[model samples]
Target chain A: MTYCIGMRIDRGLVFMSDTRTSAGVDNFATSKKMFTWCTPGERVVTIMTAGNLATTQAMISLLEERSKSQEERDPSILRQSTMFQVARLVGSTLKEVIADSSPNGQTSDDQFSASVIVGGQIGEGRPTVYLVYPQGNFIEITDDTPFFQIGETKYGKPILVRTYDKEMSFEEAIKLLLVSFDSTVKSNLSVGLPFDLMVYETDSFDTSRQKRIEQDDPVYQSISTGWGDALRDAFQLLPSYSV
Target chain B: MTYCIGMRIDRGLVFMSDTRTSAGVDNFATSKKMFTWCTPGERVVTIMTAGNLATTQAMISLLEERSKSQEERDPSILRQSTMFQVARLVGSTLKEVIADSSPNGQTSDDQFSASVIVGGQIGEGRPTVYLVYPQGNFIEITDDTPFFQIGETKYGKPILVRTYDKEMSFEEAIKLLLVSFDSTVKSNLSVGLPFDLMVYETDSFDTSRQKRIEQDDPVYQSISTGWGDALRDAFQLLPSYSV
Candidate 1:
C-alpha cells in the first residue's frame, strides 16, 4: 500500500508520497513513487502513484521511454498540449499496462488496479492536479475540493480538511502535508517514511523546489514529536465528560 | 453507516457510538446503536451495533424478549455465566437474525450482516470487550490492541492510537473518545452528532456515567473547535520544507 497527496492551492501545486511497498508482512521494500517530467523554462509535471506497484512502474517506464524520443509516441506527456491531455495519457497508459499484464481473461480488477495523481503546468496552460482512476478516467481537483488523496487517506484526512487554504505559502503547505503524513504513519503500517515532496509555484515552469524527507531527519522528528505532544495537550484542555 | 468504539482500560471499559443512520445521502435518520442490560450488583452488559440496522434491531429485540422468560430461550445473554459466553450468545443471535431476515435462502452476506462490540462483567469474570463478527465468532481486545472500532473508523483512529493509556482517567478517556468522534463527524456524513457515550469502571455492575452529546452541546462544541485550533497552531510551529 501507498499514500500520496496532491493539492492545488492559489500559490501552486504540492505533491507528496510515501515510498513503502509491501507484498505482505514479510516482504517489504523502499521504492520511489513520485516521478517528474520537466523542461527548465517550459513545463513541469509530477506524477504520484498508489496501488499495484507493477502497473504503476510499468506505466511510468512507458512514459519515460516515450518522452525521450520526439517521434516515438504521438501522445507522450512531453508532447501533450495541456495538463488535461497529460492526465488522459497517463490514465490510458495505466489501463493498457494492466490489460497486458493479466493472462487470458483471468485478471481480478482489484489485483491490477492503480491510481495516479498528475499535476503540473505546460507553457502558459493553467496549473492543476488530477486523480486518474484505474478505469482510464480522471477528475480534476476544483475549488470546492482542492486536494486529492489516495491510499490510506482517511487516517490523515481530518487535519487536511480543517487546515487546507488556497492562499497558504509553499512552506506552510509542506508543513501541513507532513503533519497529515505523520498522522497516517503513526496509525498505519502500510505507509512508512522517506516521503518525496515537491512544490511547484503556479507560473514557475521548472522543477527547482523538492525534498526527500528521510527516516531520521531532525525537522521531521521534531514535527512528529511536537504534534503528538500537542494532541495530548489539546486532549487535556478539552472540557471533560461528566455524569 | 455508523461509528462505534469500545476500549478496555485498566480503570474501566469505555464505549462511544454515533446515532446517525443513512440508506443514502438523501435518506438519513437518527437511530440508537447502544444498548445495555444490567443487574445492578450482579452482571452488566453493553452492546453496540454497526452494519445492517434491521439485523441489529431484530437481534436486540429477540434478546430482550428471551431475557424476560429464561425457559423460552436456550442461549440468552442473561443466562450466560461468563463474558465469553455472553459474547458467543450475542454473535450467534446476530447470525440467527441475519439468516431469518433473508428469504429464499438467497442472501447477500454483505446486505444483512452486522457486527457488535460487547463489553461487561459477569459474576467475578474480568471486565473486557469483545468484537463479535457476523459469522458468530468474536475476538477479545487485549492490552496491545486495547480497542475495537466499527464503521468509519480510520479518520478517528490516529488520536486514539496516540493518546490511549491503560491508566488514564475516565475524563481523559471520554475526552479522547469525543475527539475521535469529532474527527469522524467532520469528515463523514454517515456518522453524525448526538453521540452516545458510557464508561464502566472495573467490576462495577452499574451504568452511572453516560451522556448523549448533541449537536450544539457546549462542551462538545468547545472540544471540536479547540482541537481544530490546536492542529492549526501545531502546523504553524512545524519547521517548513525548503528547496
Candidate 2:
C-alpha cells in the first residue's frame, strides 16, 4: 500500500508521497512515486501514483518514453497551456498503460487500476491540484476542500479537515502536511519513509522548494514528539466523570 | 455507518460508539449501539454492535428477551461463569439471530452481517475484551493489539495507534478515545455526534463512569479546539525545506 497527499492553497501546492511498496509481509521494497515533468519556463507537472506497483511503474515508464519522443507526448503536459489539460494527459496515459498491460478482451476495469495526484502550474493562472481516479476521470480541489489524499488517507484526514485553510501561507501548509503524514506513518506499517515532499509556490511555475523527508530527520522527530505530548496534555485537561 | 471503539486497559475497559445510522445520506436516524447487562455485584457485560442495524438490534432484542424470562435468564450473560463464556454466548446468539433473519438458501454474503465487542468481568478474573465476528467466533485483545474498533475505524485509527498504551491510566484512555472519536467525526460524515462513552475500572464490577458527549458539549469543545491548535503548532515546528 501507499499514502499520497496533495494540497492547493493560496500560496501554491504541496505534494507528498511515501516510498514503501510491499507485495506481502515478506517481500518489501522501496519505489519513488513522485515524478516530475518540467520544461523549465514552459510548465511544471508533478505526478504521484498509488496502487499496484507494476501498473503505476508501467504508466510512469510510458509517460517518460512519450516525453522523450516529441510526437507521442499528447496534448503534452509539458506543452499544455492549462493545468486541466495536464490532468487529462496524465489520466489518458494511465488508462492507456493499463489497457496495454492486460490480456486481450479484458476491459479497462479488470486490467488497470491506479490513481494519481497531479499538481503544478502552467502560464499565469493559480496552481491546481487534481485527484485522478482509476477510470480516467478527475476532480479539482476547491476552496472548501483545499486538499486531496489517496492511499491510507483516513488516518491523516482529521488534521486536514479541521485545520486546512485555502489562504494559509506556504510554510503553514507544508507544516500541516508533515503532521498529517506523521499521523499516517504512525498508524500504518505499509506506508514508510523517506518521503517525497514538494512545495510549489504560487506563480513560480517551478518546484523551487522540494525535499525528501527521512525517518530520522530532526523536523519529523519534533513533529511526532510534540504532537504526542500535546495530545497527552490535552487529554489530561478534559474533565473526567465522577460517578 | 457507525464508529465504535473498545479499549482494554489495566484500569478496566473503555467503550464508545456513535449513534448515527443511515441507509443513505437521505435516510439518517439515531439509534443506540451500546448495551449493558449487569447483575450488580455478580457480573457486568457490555456489548457494542456495528454493521446491519436490523441484525444487531434483533440479536440484542433476542438476548434481552431471553434474559427477562425466568428459566433462560439464569444461564445467559447474567449467569455465565467466565468472560469467555459470555463472549461465546454473544457470538452464538449473533449467529442464531442472523440465521433466523435471512433464510440459509437465499442469504447473500453480507445479508445479516454483525460484529460485536464484548468485555467485562465475572467471578474473580481480570477484565477481558473479545471481538466477536459474524461467524460466531471471536479473538481476544492481546497485549500487542489492545484495542478493537468496528465500523468506520480507519478514520480514527491514527490517534489510537499513536497514543494507546497497555498501562495507560483510565483517565488517559478516555481522553485518547475522545480525540480518536473527534478525528473520526471530522473525517467521515456517516459517523456523527452524541457519542456514547462508558468506562469501567478493574475489579469495580460496575459502570463507574459513563457519559453521552453531545455536539456542543463543553469538554468536547475543548478537545476539538485544543487538538486542532496542537496539531498546527506541531506542524509549524517542523524544519522548512531549502528553496
Candidate 3:
C-alpha cells in the first residue's frame, strides 16, 4: 500500500509520496517513490509511483539508463517537448517494464500493475500533473480536477477535495498536503514516513525545493499534533444536531 | 456503492447509512439500507448493508420472512439471546441468500458479495456493534475499534478515528456522522442522501431518536456547510512548512 498525491495549483505544482512498500504485513520496506529528472531552465519532471515495487524500480532505472544518452530506442524525459509527452513516455515505459517481467506474457495479475503520477513544467508550458494508469494511458489535471492521488487514496481525499484552492500559496499547499498525508498515515499502517515532497513553481523548469520528512521531523510533528488538536476543536464547534 | 457507519460509544450505539444505490453511474436510485428489528424494551437490532443491493435486499427479506413465524426454516433475530447471535443469524442468512442466488455452486464472482454492520442492544446485553462479512464470519467492535464502516468507507474514516470519543453525547455522535456522510456524498457520486440515522442510547431498549436526513435538511445543511468552512479555517491555522 502507498499514498501519493500531486496537485496543479495556480502558482505551481506539488507532489508528495509515502516511502513505505509492503508485500504483506511482515515484508515491508522503505523505498523512495519520488524520482526526479531535470535539465535546468528547460524541463523538470517528478514522477511518483505506486504498486509493484520491482516494476516501478525497473521503470525508473530503465528510464534513467535510456535517458542518459538518447538513442532511437530510448529518449530523455528532459528532452520531452511538453509535459504531455513526458507523461506518455513514462506511461509507455511503465507498461513496457511490467510486460517484460510478467510471466507467460500475461499482465493479468495485479502484482504487475502500477500507477504513476507525473507532474512538472517544460520550457514555457504550464506546470501540470498527470496520473498515468497501468495500461500506459494518462490524464492531465485540469481546474475541475486540480489534483491526482493514487494508492490508499480514500482516507486522505476528503480534506483535499474540501480545502483545495486554485490560488493558495505554495506554503498553504504544502501544509494541506501534510495534513492529508498525516490523515492517511494514521489510518493505514502500510503508508508511513518518511514522506517525499517536491514544490515546483510554475515555469521554473528547475527542481530545487524538495525535502524528505522523517518521522521525528519537528516541523512535521508540530503539524500533525496541531492538526489533530484543531480537528477536535473544530469538531466541537459544530452545531449540535437536534431531534 | 454505499456508505454506512456504525459507532459504539459510551452513551450507546449509532448507525448511519446512505440510501442512494447505483449499479453504475447511470442507474442510481434511492433504496433504504438501514433495517431495524426491534421488540422495544427487549432487543433493538439495526442492520446496515452495503455492496450487491440484490444480495443484501434478498438476505434481509429472507431473514424477515423466516423470522416472522419461525416454524423451522429460520430463527428470529429478535429472540436471539445476544447481539452476537443476532449478528450470526444475519451473517448466515446473508451467506445463504447469496449462495442460493449464485448460478454456480462456487461464489467466484464479487457480484454476489455484500457486507453488513449490525448494531444494537439485546435485553441486558451491552450495546455493541458487529461487522458481518459476506463469508458468514463476523468481527465484534472493541474499544480499540470503536466503529465499523462498510463499503466506500475510506473517505469518511479518518474523521471518525480522530474525533471519536467514548463519552461524547449522542448529539455529538450524530453531528460527527453527518459530517462523515456529507464528505462521502461530495466525493463519491454513488453515495448520497437521504441518510438514515439511528441513535440507540445504552439500555434504552428503544429507538426514538431515529431520523432520515434529506439533502436539504436545515441541520444537515448547516453541518455540511459548516464542516467545509471549518476545515478550510483549520487548514489556514496550521503552521506553514518552511523549506
| lDDT at position B36, candidate 2 | 88
- Residue B53 local lDDT, model 1: 91
Best by TM-score: 3
Query: Model 3: residues >4 Å from true position, as ranges?
Result: A66-75, A104-109, B66-75, B106-109
Q: List the residue pairs that clash in candidate 1.
A: none
Q: Write the per-residue lDDT of candidate 3 for residues A1-243, one digit (tens) a residue.
A: 899999988889999999999999999999999999888878888999999998899898877875455555443676688889999999999989888877666355557889999988888888889999888999989999999999999889899999988999999998999999999998889999999999998877777899999999998999999998998899888899965
Regions of candidate 2 where Cα sits further than 4 Å from its true position: A66-75, A99-111, A241-243, B66-75, B99-111, B165-169, B234-243
Q: What residue pairs are clashing in model 3?
A: none
DockQ of every candidate structure:
0.72, 0.49, 0.78
Candidate 1, lDDT over the whole model? 0.89
How high is each candidate's interface RMSD, in Å? 1.2, 2.7, 0.9
Q: Between the candidate structures 1 and 2, which one is better when assessed by TM-score? A: 1
Tens digits of per-residue lDDT for model 2, B1-243: 889998898778899999999999999999999998887777788899998899899888877775476665553567678999989999999988787777553244666788999988886988888999998999998888899999998878887877788787776777788888888888788999899988888777787577888889887787777777766665555555343
lDDT of 2 by residue, A103-192 (tens): 773364463577899988887867888999877789998887788888888888888887788887777776777778888888888989
Tens-digit lDDT string for candidate 1 (B129-214): 99999878899999999999998999999999999998988888888899999999999889998999998988788898788889
